[model samples]
Target: MKTEKFQTILVSASILGLAIMFGCAAFQDAIVPCYISPDALDYADANATTFLPWTTLFDARRIDRFMDFRHLWIQAEDNLQYNFLKGLNAFHIRGSEELKTILFSPTGPIGLAFPALAGGALGTYLFSKPKDKRKIAELEKENKK
Candidate 1:
Protein backbone atom coordinates (compact mmCIF):
# COMPACT_ATOMS: atom_id res chain seq x y z
CA MET A 1 0.00 0.00 0.00
CA LYS A 2 2.78 2.43 0.80
CA THR A 3 4.57 1.56 -2.43
CA GLU A 4 1.42 2.21 -4.41
CA LYS A 5 0.97 5.63 -2.83
CA PHE A 6 4.61 6.56 -3.55
CA GLN A 7 4.21 5.58 -7.20
CA THR A 8 1.11 7.73 -7.47
CA ILE A 9 2.99 10.74 -6.11
CA LEU A 10 5.94 10.20 -8.44
CA VAL A 11 3.77 9.98 -11.56
CA SER A 12 1.85 13.10 -10.56
CA ALA A 13 5.09 15.07 -9.99
CA SER A 14 6.61 14.08 -13.35
CA ILE A 15 3.49 15.16 -15.25
CA LEU A 16 3.24 18.50 -13.44
CA GLY A 17 6.96 19.36 -13.77
CA LEU A 18 7.15 18.62 -17.50
CA ALA A 19 3.94 20.57 -18.15
CA ILE A 20 5.25 23.70 -16.42
CA MET A 21 8.61 23.54 -18.22
CA PHE A 22 7.01 23.34 -21.67
CA GLY A 23 4.41 26.03 -20.91
CA CYS A 24 7.04 28.58 -19.84
CA ALA A 25 9.21 27.85 -22.91
CA ALA A 26 6.22 28.31 -25.20
CA PHE A 27 5.34 31.65 -23.62
CA GLN A 28 8.90 32.93 -24.00
CA ASP A 29 9.19 31.91 -27.67
CA ALA A 30 5.80 33.33 -28.73
CA ILE A 31 6.55 36.89 -27.61
CA VAL A 32 6.18 39.48 -30.42
CA PRO A 33 8.88 41.70 -28.77
CA CYS A 34 7.41 44.94 -30.02
CA TYR A 35 4.23 46.91 -29.38
CA ILE A 36 2.79 50.37 -28.76
CA SER A 37 1.47 51.24 -25.33
CA PRO A 38 -1.16 53.65 -23.95
CA ASP A 39 1.64 55.64 -22.35
CA ALA A 40 3.36 56.02 -25.71
CA LEU A 41 0.11 57.27 -27.18
CA ASP A 42 -0.17 59.94 -24.50
CA TYR A 43 3.41 61.08 -25.20
CA ALA A 44 2.90 61.08 -28.98
CA ASP A 45 2.82 64.33 -30.94
CA ALA A 46 1.79 65.13 -34.50
CA ASN A 47 5.46 64.52 -35.46
CA ALA A 48 5.82 61.21 -33.65
CA THR A 49 7.14 58.25 -35.61
CA THR A 50 8.83 54.84 -35.14
CA PHE A 51 11.57 54.02 -37.64
CA LEU A 52 12.14 50.41 -38.69
CA PRO A 53 14.03 47.93 -36.46
CA TRP A 54 13.72 50.29 -33.47
CA THR A 55 11.36 48.12 -31.43
CA THR A 56 13.58 46.23 -28.98
CA LEU A 57 13.26 42.85 -27.28
CA PHE A 58 11.33 44.42 -24.39
CA ASP A 59 9.25 47.41 -25.50
CA ALA A 60 7.33 47.95 -22.25
CA ARG A 61 10.56 48.40 -20.32
CA ARG A 62 11.84 51.35 -22.31
CA ILE A 63 11.21 53.61 -25.29
CA ASP A 64 13.11 52.95 -28.50
CA ARG A 65 15.46 55.45 -30.13
CA PHE A 66 14.10 57.81 -32.81
CA MET A 67 16.68 56.70 -35.39
CA ASP A 68 19.11 53.88 -34.67
CA PHE A 69 20.68 50.83 -36.26
CA ARG A 70 18.36 48.08 -37.48
CA HIS A 71 17.19 45.93 -34.54
CA LEU A 72 15.55 43.48 -36.96
CA TRP A 73 17.36 40.19 -36.89
CA ILE A 74 19.47 40.15 -33.62
CA GLN A 75 17.88 37.23 -38.77
CA ALA A 76 15.14 39.31 -40.12
CA GLU A 77 13.78 37.32 -43.05
CA ASP A 78 13.56 40.46 -45.24
CA ASN A 79 15.52 43.33 -43.67
CA LEU A 80 18.97 44.82 -43.26
CA GLN A 81 21.30 42.80 -40.98
CA TYR A 82 23.43 44.25 -38.21
CA ASN A 83 26.55 46.09 -39.33
CA PHE A 84 29.95 44.31 -38.94
CA LEU A 85 28.34 41.13 -37.57
CA LYS A 86 27.95 42.68 -34.11
CA GLY A 87 24.71 40.83 -33.35
CA LEU A 88 26.22 37.42 -34.11
CA ASN A 89 29.26 38.23 -31.99
CA ALA A 90 27.03 39.16 -29.05
CA PHE A 91 25.11 35.91 -29.41
CA HIS A 92 28.31 33.84 -29.42
CA ILE A 93 29.59 35.67 -26.34
CA ARG A 94 26.44 34.91 -24.36
CA GLY A 95 26.50 31.25 -25.47
CA SER A 96 30.14 30.92 -24.38
CA GLU A 97 29.26 32.21 -20.92
CA GLU A 98 26.42 29.68 -20.63
CA LEU A 99 28.67 26.81 -21.74
CA LYS A 100 31.34 27.82 -19.26
CA THR A 101 28.88 27.81 -16.38
CA ILE A 102 27.51 24.36 -17.21
CA LEU A 103 30.93 22.87 -17.73
CA PHE A 104 32.52 24.31 -14.59
CA SER A 105 29.69 24.06 -12.07
CA PRO A 106 29.27 20.87 -10.02
CA THR A 107 25.59 21.69 -9.72
CA GLY A 108 25.09 21.32 -13.47
CA PRO A 109 24.14 17.68 -12.94
CA ILE A 110 21.63 18.73 -10.30
CA GLY A 111 19.40 20.01 -13.10
CA LEU A 112 19.66 16.62 -14.84
CA ALA A 113 18.76 14.60 -11.72
CA PHE A 114 15.07 15.58 -11.72
CA PRO A 115 14.07 14.04 -15.05
CA ALA A 116 16.23 10.99 -14.36
CA LEU A 117 14.52 10.30 -11.05
CA ALA A 118 11.04 11.11 -12.32
CA GLY A 119 11.37 8.86 -15.35
CA GLY A 120 12.97 6.09 -13.31
CA ALA A 121 10.21 6.17 -10.73
CA LEU A 122 7.45 6.12 -13.32
CA GLY A 123 9.08 3.37 -15.38
CA THR A 124 9.76 1.17 -12.35
CA TYR A 125 6.23 1.68 -11.12
CA LEU A 126 4.80 0.66 -14.48
CA PHE A 127 7.12 -2.25 -15.41
CA SER A 128 7.92 -3.77 -12.01
CA LYS A 129 6.88 -7.38 -11.37
CA PRO A 130 3.93 -7.88 -9.06
CA LYS A 131 4.50 -9.38 -5.58
CA ASP A 132 3.48 -12.99 -4.90
CA LYS A 133 -0.18 -13.16 -3.93
CA ARG A 134 0.39 -16.45 -2.05
CA LYS A 135 2.98 -14.88 0.23
CA ILE A 136 0.70 -11.93 1.03
CA ALA A 137 -2.23 -14.24 1.72
CA GLU A 138 -0.19 -16.40 4.06
CA LEU A 139 1.07 -13.38 5.91
CA GLU A 140 -2.44 -12.01 6.36
CA LYS A 141 -3.66 -15.39 7.73
CA GLU A 142 -0.80 -15.52 10.20
CA ASN A 143 -1.65 -12.01 11.38
CA LYS A 144 -5.27 -13.01 11.99
CA LYS A 145 -4.15 -15.80 14.38
Candidate 2:
Protein backbone atom coordinates (compact mmCIF):
# COMPACT_ATOMS: atom_id res chain seq x y z
CA MET A 1 0.00 0.00 0.00
CA LYS A 2 2.78 2.43 0.89
CA THR A 3 4.71 1.59 -2.28
CA GLU A 4 1.62 2.18 -4.38
CA LYS A 5 1.02 5.53 -2.70
CA PHE A 6 4.65 6.51 -3.29
CA GLN A 7 4.36 5.64 -6.97
CA THR A 8 1.23 7.71 -7.28
CA ILE A 9 2.95 10.70 -5.67
CA LEU A 10 5.97 10.37 -7.97
CA VAL A 11 3.78 10.25 -11.07
CA SER A 12 1.85 13.35 -10.01
CA ALA A 13 5.06 15.26 -9.29
CA SER A 14 6.54 14.30 -12.65
CA ILE A 15 3.44 15.47 -14.50
CA LEU A 16 3.46 18.83 -12.68
CA GLY A 17 7.17 19.28 -13.38
CA LEU A 18 6.63 18.61 -17.09
CA ALA A 19 3.79 21.14 -17.21
CA ILE A 20 5.95 23.86 -15.63
CA MET A 21 8.84 23.17 -18.00
CA PHE A 22 6.58 23.34 -21.05
CA GLY A 23 5.12 26.65 -19.93
CA CYS A 24 8.58 28.13 -19.36
CA ALA A 25 9.83 27.09 -22.80
CA ALA A 26 6.71 28.43 -24.52
CA PHE A 27 6.99 31.77 -22.75
CA GLN A 28 10.68 32.16 -23.60
CA ASP A 29 10.13 31.40 -27.28
CA ALA A 30 7.16 33.72 -27.61
CA ILE A 31 8.82 36.74 -25.99
CA VAL A 32 12.18 36.52 -27.79
CA PRO A 33 12.50 38.64 -30.97
CA CYS A 34 13.04 36.61 -34.13
CA TYR A 35 12.00 38.78 -37.10
CA ILE A 36 14.47 41.67 -37.15
CA SER A 37 15.93 42.42 -40.64
CA PRO A 38 19.39 43.90 -41.26
CA ASP A 39 18.09 46.10 -44.07
CA ALA A 40 15.80 47.94 -41.70
CA LEU A 41 18.81 49.15 -39.68
CA ASP A 42 20.60 50.28 -42.84
CA TYR A 43 17.57 52.21 -44.00
CA ALA A 44 17.18 53.97 -40.67
CA ASP A 45 20.83 55.06 -40.68
CA ALA A 46 20.64 56.29 -44.30
CA ASN A 47 17.59 58.43 -43.56
CA ALA A 48 19.30 60.05 -40.59
CA THR A 49 22.44 60.77 -42.65
CA THR A 50 20.44 62.25 -45.58
CA PHE A 51 18.55 64.63 -43.26
CA LEU A 52 21.84 66.26 -42.15
CA PRO A 53 22.62 67.62 -45.67
CA TRP A 54 19.08 68.95 -46.14
CA THR A 55 19.36 71.23 -43.09
CA THR A 56 22.11 73.29 -44.86
CA LEU A 57 20.80 73.33 -48.51
CA PHE A 58 17.06 73.82 -48.04
CA ASP A 59 15.10 76.75 -46.57
CA ALA A 60 13.52 76.32 -43.11
CA ARG A 61 10.18 75.10 -44.48
CA ARG A 62 11.74 72.54 -46.81
CA ILE A 63 14.22 71.39 -44.15
CA ASP A 64 11.39 71.11 -41.66
CA ARG A 65 9.37 69.00 -44.09
CA PHE A 66 12.29 66.62 -44.79
CA MET A 67 13.14 66.34 -41.11
CA ASP A 68 9.52 65.69 -40.26
CA PHE A 69 9.33 62.90 -42.82
CA ARG A 70 12.53 61.31 -41.60
CA HIS A 71 11.47 61.54 -37.98
CA LEU A 72 8.06 60.02 -38.73
CA TRP A 73 9.51 57.13 -40.73
CA ILE A 74 12.06 56.28 -38.08
CA GLN A 75 9.45 56.54 -35.33
CA ALA A 76 6.99 54.35 -37.23
CA GLU A 77 9.48 51.53 -37.69
CA ASP A 78 10.73 51.72 -34.11
CA ASN A 79 7.22 51.84 -32.73
CA LEU A 80 6.21 48.77 -34.74
CA GLN A 81 9.06 46.67 -33.36
CA TYR A 82 8.72 48.13 -29.89
CA ASN A 83 5.01 47.43 -29.65
CA PHE A 84 5.40 43.89 -31.02
CA LEU A 85 8.03 42.93 -28.45
CA LYS A 86 6.13 44.69 -25.70
CA GLY A 87 2.98 42.73 -26.41
CA LEU A 88 4.80 39.41 -26.58
CA ASN A 89 6.66 40.14 -23.33
CA ALA A 90 3.46 41.22 -21.65
CA PHE A 91 1.67 37.98 -22.62
CA HIS A 92 4.54 35.77 -21.44
CA ILE A 93 4.97 37.70 -18.19
CA ARG A 94 1.26 37.65 -17.48
CA GLY A 95 1.11 33.86 -17.92
CA SER A 96 4.04 33.29 -15.56
CA GLU A 97 2.65 35.75 -13.03
CA GLU A 98 -0.73 34.08 -13.14
CA LEU A 99 0.84 30.68 -12.50
CA LYS A 100 2.82 32.12 -9.60
CA THR A 101 -0.28 33.75 -8.20
CA ILE A 102 -2.21 30.49 -8.38
CA LEU A 103 0.61 28.60 -6.71
CA PHE A 104 1.52 31.04 -3.93
CA SER A 105 -1.47 33.17 -3.18
CA PRO A 106 -2.14 34.43 0.36
CA THR A 107 -5.55 32.84 0.39
CA GLY A 108 -4.26 29.30 -0.15
CA PRO A 109 -2.59 26.90 -2.59
CA ILE A 110 -5.22 26.90 -5.28
CA GLY A 111 -3.12 24.98 -7.76
CA LEU A 112 -2.39 21.79 -5.80
CA ALA A 113 -5.67 21.71 -3.93
CA PHE A 114 -7.90 21.21 -6.95
CA PRO A 115 -5.72 18.48 -8.44
CA ALA A 116 -5.35 16.73 -5.08
CA LEU A 117 -9.09 16.73 -4.50
CA ALA A 118 -9.78 15.41 -7.98
CA GLY A 119 -7.16 12.66 -7.67
CA GLY A 120 -8.35 11.68 -4.23
CA ALA A 121 -11.93 11.45 -5.36
CA LEU A 122 -11.03 9.39 -8.40
CA GLY A 123 -8.87 7.03 -6.39
CA THR A 124 -11.55 6.60 -3.75
CA TYR A 125 -14.21 5.78 -6.30
CA LEU A 126 -12.02 3.27 -8.10
CA PHE A 127 -10.87 1.44 -4.95
CA SER A 128 -14.08 1.51 -2.90
CA LYS A 129 -16.05 -1.22 -4.67
CA PRO A 130 -15.13 -4.87 -4.37
CA LYS A 131 -14.41 -6.66 -7.67
CA ASP A 132 -16.86 -9.51 -8.51
CA LYS A 133 -17.03 -10.94 -5.00
CA ARG A 134 -19.81 -13.44 -5.79
CA LYS A 135 -18.00 -14.77 -8.82
CA ILE A 136 -14.80 -15.21 -6.83
CA ALA A 137 -16.69 -16.98 -4.05
CA GLU A 138 -18.48 -19.30 -6.47
CA LEU A 139 -15.25 -20.16 -8.23
CA GLU A 140 -13.55 -20.86 -4.92
CA LYS A 141 -16.43 -23.20 -3.87
CA GLU A 142 -16.36 -25.06 -7.21
CA ASN A 143 -12.60 -25.46 -7.02
CA LYS A 144 -12.87 -26.86 -3.51
CA LYS A 145 -15.56 -29.34 -4.60
Candidate 3:
Protein backbone atom coordinates (compact mmCIF):
# COMPACT_ATOMS: atom_id res chain seq x y z
CA MET A 1 0.00 0.00 0.00
CA LYS A 2 2.83 2.37 0.87
CA THR A 3 4.63 1.58 -2.38
CA GLU A 4 1.46 2.19 -4.38
CA LYS A 5 0.99 5.55 -2.68
CA PHE A 6 4.61 6.47 -3.42
CA GLN A 7 4.15 5.48 -7.03
CA THR A 8 1.11 7.67 -7.41
CA ILE A 9 2.93 10.65 -5.95
CA LEU A 10 5.95 9.98 -8.11
CA VAL A 11 3.86 9.76 -11.27
CA SER A 12 2.04 12.97 -10.41
CA ALA A 13 5.29 14.83 -9.80
CA SER A 14 6.77 13.50 -13.02
CA ILE A 15 3.73 14.62 -15.00
CA LEU A 16 3.91 18.06 -13.45
CA GLY A 17 7.61 18.34 -14.17
CA LEU A 18 7.17 17.27 -17.78
CA ALA A 19 4.27 19.63 -18.23
CA ILE A 20 6.30 22.59 -16.98
CA MET A 21 9.25 21.62 -19.11
CA PHE A 22 7.51 20.82 -22.39
CA GLY A 23 4.63 23.28 -22.16
CA CYS A 24 6.42 26.15 -23.88
CA ALA A 25 8.14 25.85 -27.21
CA ALA A 26 11.80 25.74 -26.28
CA PHE A 27 13.08 28.70 -28.33
CA GLN A 28 9.81 30.61 -28.28
CA ASP A 29 9.81 31.56 -24.61
CA ALA A 30 12.04 34.66 -24.75
CA ILE A 31 13.45 37.14 -27.22
CA VAL A 32 17.16 37.07 -27.90
CA PRO A 33 18.38 40.34 -29.31
CA CYS A 34 20.69 40.15 -32.32
CA TYR A 35 22.39 43.11 -33.92
CA ILE A 36 24.90 43.92 -36.65
CA SER A 37 26.44 47.36 -36.59
CA PRO A 38 26.98 49.30 -39.79
CA ASP A 39 29.98 50.78 -37.96
CA ALA A 40 31.38 47.25 -37.88
CA LEU A 41 32.19 47.92 -41.53
CA ASP A 42 35.08 50.07 -40.33
CA TYR A 43 36.72 46.96 -38.92
CA ALA A 44 35.30 44.53 -41.48
CA ASP A 45 36.29 44.63 -45.13
CA ALA A 46 36.06 42.29 -48.07
CA ASN A 47 39.49 40.92 -47.17
CA ALA A 48 38.97 41.26 -43.43
CA THR A 49 38.26 38.19 -41.34
CA THR A 50 34.67 38.47 -40.12
CA PHE A 51 34.15 34.98 -38.79
CA LEU A 52 35.72 34.33 -35.43
CA PRO A 53 36.59 30.80 -34.37
CA TRP A 54 34.00 29.08 -32.13
CA THR A 55 36.19 29.16 -29.04
CA THR A 56 36.80 32.87 -29.36
CA LEU A 57 33.12 33.57 -29.94
CA PHE A 58 32.46 32.56 -26.30
CA ASP A 59 34.43 33.96 -23.39
CA ALA A 60 37.00 31.75 -21.63
CA ARG A 61 35.78 32.71 -18.15
CA ARG A 62 32.20 32.09 -19.17
CA ILE A 63 33.20 28.70 -20.59
CA ASP A 64 34.78 27.82 -17.24
CA ARG A 65 31.51 28.86 -15.60
CA PHE A 66 29.64 26.49 -17.97
CA MET A 67 27.41 29.20 -19.40
CA ASP A 68 26.74 27.02 -22.42
CA PHE A 69 25.09 24.39 -20.20
CA ARG A 70 21.99 26.51 -19.75
CA HIS A 71 18.99 26.26 -22.07
CA LEU A 72 18.79 30.05 -22.26
CA TRP A 73 22.27 30.29 -23.67
CA ILE A 74 21.58 27.53 -26.14
CA GLN A 75 18.40 29.21 -27.31
CA ALA A 76 20.07 32.61 -27.44
CA GLU A 77 22.96 31.28 -29.45
CA ASP A 78 20.56 29.73 -31.95
CA ASN A 79 18.66 32.99 -32.25
CA LEU A 80 21.87 34.92 -32.75
CA GLN A 81 23.04 32.55 -35.46
CA TYR A 82 19.71 32.64 -37.25
CA ASN A 83 19.50 36.42 -37.05
CA PHE A 84 23.06 36.87 -38.26
CA LEU A 85 22.50 34.76 -41.34
CA LYS A 86 19.14 36.32 -41.99
CA GLY A 87 20.67 39.79 -41.69
CA LEU A 88 23.53 38.89 -43.96
CA ASN A 89 21.14 37.56 -46.58
CA ALA A 90 18.99 40.64 -46.34
CA PHE A 91 22.01 42.87 -46.73
CA HIS A 92 23.32 40.90 -49.67
CA ILE A 93 19.96 41.07 -51.39
CA ARG A 94 20.22 44.83 -51.14
CA GLY A 95 23.73 44.77 -52.72
CA SER A 96 26.06 44.95 -49.76
CA GLU A 97 29.43 43.54 -50.84
CA GLU A 98 30.79 43.04 -47.33
CA LEU A 99 27.79 40.98 -46.33
CA LYS A 100 27.97 39.19 -49.65
CA THR A 101 31.48 38.04 -48.84
CA ILE A 102 30.35 36.79 -45.47
CA LEU A 103 27.19 35.14 -46.76
CA PHE A 104 28.34 33.65 -50.06
CA SER A 105 31.91 32.83 -49.20
CA PRO A 106 33.48 29.40 -49.62
CA THR A 107 31.85 28.04 -46.45
CA GLY A 108 28.26 28.57 -47.66
CA PRO A 109 25.14 27.47 -45.73
CA ILE A 110 26.43 24.13 -44.44
CA GLY A 111 27.55 25.53 -41.08
CA LEU A 112 24.21 27.27 -40.51
CA ALA A 113 22.15 24.09 -40.84
CA PHE A 114 24.04 22.05 -38.22
CA PRO A 115 22.99 23.75 -34.98
CA ALA A 116 19.37 24.37 -35.99
CA LEU A 117 18.92 20.71 -36.94
CA ALA A 118 20.74 19.36 -33.88
CA GLY A 119 18.79 21.53 -31.41
CA GLY A 120 15.46 20.53 -32.99
CA ALA A 121 16.36 16.86 -32.79
CA LEU A 122 17.45 17.13 -29.15
CA GLY A 123 14.26 18.94 -28.09
CA THR A 124 12.14 16.39 -29.92
CA TYR A 125 13.91 13.43 -28.31
CA LEU A 126 13.70 14.89 -24.81
CA PHE A 127 9.95 15.62 -25.01
CA SER A 128 8.80 12.52 -26.90
CA LYS A 129 9.96 9.88 -24.39
CA PRO A 130 7.31 8.76 -21.93
CA LYS A 131 8.12 8.75 -18.22
CA ASP A 132 9.70 5.48 -17.17
CA LYS A 133 8.39 3.84 -14.00
CA ARG A 134 11.63 1.97 -13.43
CA LYS A 135 13.54 5.21 -13.13
CA ILE A 136 10.80 6.73 -11.00
CA ALA A 137 10.84 3.81 -8.60
CA GLU A 138 14.58 3.99 -8.29
CA LEU A 139 14.34 7.70 -7.47
CA GLU A 140 11.59 7.05 -4.91
CA LYS A 141 13.73 4.46 -3.18
CA GLU A 142 16.64 6.85 -3.00
CA ASN A 143 14.47 9.51 -1.41
CA LYS A 144 13.13 7.14 1.27
CA LYS A 145 16.56 6.83 2.84
- Best of the candidates, lDDT: 2
* lDDT score, candidate 3, position 100: 69
List the candidates' TM-scores in order. Answer: 0.24, 0.32, 0.21
> If both were scored by lDDT, which would come out higher, candidate 1 or candidate 2?
2
lDDT for model 2 comes to: 0.66
List lDDT for all candidates, in order: 0.60, 0.66, 0.58
**Model 1 lDDT tens row, 1-145:** 9999999999999999999989877655235455555555345321223333534334433343321222342246343454447778898999999988886565676557767788999998776445656777889999999
Candidate numbers sorted by TM-score from highest down: 2, 1, 3
Cα shift from native, residue 36, model 3 (Å)? 7.7
Clashes of each: 0, 0, 0
Candidate 3 at 85: error in angstroms?
A: 36
Candidate achieving higher TM-score, 2 or 3: 2
On residues 90-134, what C-alpha lDDT tens digit does candidate 3 reach at each position? 977877766666666656564566666789899987765455667
The residue-level lDDT of candidate 1 at 40 comes to 59
> Clashing pairs in model 2?
none
What TM-score should be assigned to candidate 1? 0.24
Tens digits of lDDT, candidate 2, 10-123? 999999999999987765533443332335434434332223432222233333465568789889999999999999999999999988887877555876687788999999
